[model samples]
Target: MNNSVFRRLLLPGVIVLAGCSGSTDPETAHLFDNVKNLNNGEYDRQIASKDAEAAAIVRQNNAASARISTLRNQSASNSAEIKALTSQISSLRAQTSSLRGKFSNQPDKLAQLNQLDGQLVQIRADVGAGTSPSVARAELNRVSAAIRALSR
Candidate 1:
């Protein structure tokens, strides 16, 4: 009976001490909450930083896409201009050849026709080598004026 009483008393005391040791204080709970809030803040900051980086990447990609589109359009326009210039040069060469036969008897007119023919060849080379449309057109206009003078 004495041993049973001692066991019962010792067991309850040990349990109470263990429970007190394990129990958290109000300040400890507050500290845990503070730590949790800090972690949440840090996580949010990291997420925001990642989102900003992603947005920047998207913006860069969009700019590159736009530039590519613009280059493609310019390339298409250049091809069309090249085709038109080539056709115009061919027609001018034909016209100059015909004028050459007509002005054969007149040395001055024939000389001018020869000069126009040279000009046309140079312009055709410029156009073939990717000269700007405006520069090629200006050269063609000058050659056409020379041809008109020879025509008279």
Candidate 2:
């Protein structure tokens, strides 16, 4: 009788302990997967690649922005330089024309003007944007000035 009673007590305790012990299987209420069961290495690598790509994109954008700012500064300086050089070139040409009334070599003055024009074109191109808008405007103005100089 005592053995029967002890068995009855032990059976309920064992059942209660089993119920209290948490099961390894995840509950249905949870949404994301458990980190431990990440079996597929490919999926992990893909996720990391996506994250790295996103970070690289942001870094690229930041680098582009910095480049744009540098271009803008160069553009502004070039614009000023173009204005000064244009004024100087005009003066030099006028003086050369006066001198040509006495001398014979017209090719020399023309060659000098052409060389300066090339420099001006290059400056304009550099001022133009790889990514920046502010620099593009500066570059365009200088380019227009250079074009006008050439047309003359």
lDDT (Cα) of model 1: 0.80
- Can you write out model 1's per-residue Cα lDDT over 1-152, one digit (the tens) per residue? 99999999999986665454321332443444445545557546756788999999999999999999999999999999888888888898899898878977899888878888888899888888888899999888888877777687
Give candidate 2 misplaced runs (Cα > 4 Å). 1-51, 94-152
TM-score to native of every candidate shown: 0.72, 0.34
Clashes of each: 0, 0
Candidate RMSDs in Å, in order, are: 9.5, 11.6
Residue-level lDDT tens digits of model 2 in 57-147: 9999999999999999998987776566555545544543454444345566556545555654554455342424455446545545644
Scored by lDDT, model 2 comes in at: 0.57
**Weakest 10 consecutive residues of candidate 2 by summed lDDT:** 28-37
In angstroms, the error of model 2 at 44 is: 8.8
